[model samples]
Target: MTAIKPVIEGTDITSVEVGNTTLKLKQTVSLDSLQELISAVENFSKFFDLTSLGSADEGIKTEWNEQDLTQFLSKETREDQIVALKVLSDKGEVTREEFLNEMKKLLKNPGFRGWDLGGLLAGLSIRSRTWGYESPYIKEERREGNEWDTFYRIKERYAPLIKKWLKERGP
Candidate 1:
């Protein structure tokens, strides 16, 4: 039979060993001692003032560190915008002005960082011709004679790469 290990608290015999069994001797513990033991068990089971037992501090710490996503807001990327546009377009058929208004409102949110622009555009451009806001500065960039063609070409190239990245990142 395996050797049993008894538990001692100072001079008090908390538990006794008989063959391979450990029998608890002090059934009525002091309030402080009971609270401590309960807290220790709640903190880490198998803790009976035994030096051989391990602590669960790391596991508890990790479990506590996970983010609470209920408070988090989803960010924007072209991909996300595109996807949003697609879904919104399918369900309600919003006008360009309405869509831009919604996008503007979404952009103002603290959590709405521009991350999924490609997906956003994929979802957005089908029913719309403009971004959320009209800018005199941006108009020059989209002009035919301007170097904005380079920017447009770059985005055209960006689609496939973005699609691949989003696929790897998952829905």
Candidate 2:
């Protein structure tokens, strides 16, 4: 078996080689990027509806539900956000304001600094393009644009951090 290895070439560069293929990424990673990367990998299974891709009984639907929405939104509380910041920080020493600023960048919501639960729900709803008073859920829109590309790039750059976070979070 060929062992794949990933290397951090610099503060803003990472490279991974597998068999005959190599991938490289360059990005200034932040705590918010790390957190977003972790969340993306952790929730990857919920991004697709496998049941709809094949025989209805052959595969399970992995779409996010109301419970998932509730759990996600619950993490927006001040205390929970603080915990998230601690988890994402290098030494658990980041301030609440800085954490909130990073979160705003991660979520691409400029108004997130002042966001409460209602604002968060509203922002998520708008981003998901649900357009109405409804629970936030992932939609079936194809990922595009520089934002999505940057997300994947950051994910690649911070795969190790994401793995560590996932391990700490447990199964």
Candidate 3:
């Protein structure tokens, strides 16, 4: 029998098959919905070693400051950064302006990094497809000041350097 090695990436899941009935899973699912999924695995257990399988561990971990304001948001190591941004954007539940304002505040902190920004931008790109008229990056910059006001300003100013980075590593 071939050893069934499982590899997980972000929320995406894949399974190797040594027998019939290939396994598959949708990356986008809630923890509460997992209980129902066990039935599927249980039925398949007769053929495969389901003993190694466990509950679906997903979702984010966010905290609030003593002042009752949000301090930080965190998610599973395997959780995609874009997924986290989607959660934040959903929870904020704001109009475009309000959302951008929130992003500006989040970005101003020294701790924010390119990964965070990329995630937000990527999420915004996805959300915009359905919501319409929301450019998280531009809006985020506006919140801080202007697209030319934030670090992106320098990025734009140094277009050649930015292009080099893009050429080496496409967005």
Identify the candidate with maximal TM-score: 2
CA lDDT, every prediction?
A: 0.35, 0.37, 0.36
Candidate 1 structure quality by residue, lDDT tens digits, 6-94: 45554443654434334444352444464465444444423443334332221222111112111111232354454443334333434
Candidate with the greatest lDDT versus the true structure: 2
Give me the overall lDDT of model 3.
Answer: 0.36
Question: Residue by residue across 6-63, what tens digits does model 2's lDDT show?
Answer: 4333332143343443333343344435445434433643674322332212232333
At residue 101, candidate 1 shows an lDDT of: 47
Worst 10 residues of 1 by lDDT: 134-143
Decoy 2 TM-score against native? 0.21
User: Is 2 or 3 the stronger prediction by TM-score?
Assistant: 2
Supply the global lDDT for candidate 1. 0.35
Record all residue pairs in model 3 with backbone atoms less than 3 Å apart, i.e. clashing.
Answer: none
**Each model's backbone clash number:** 22, 0, 0
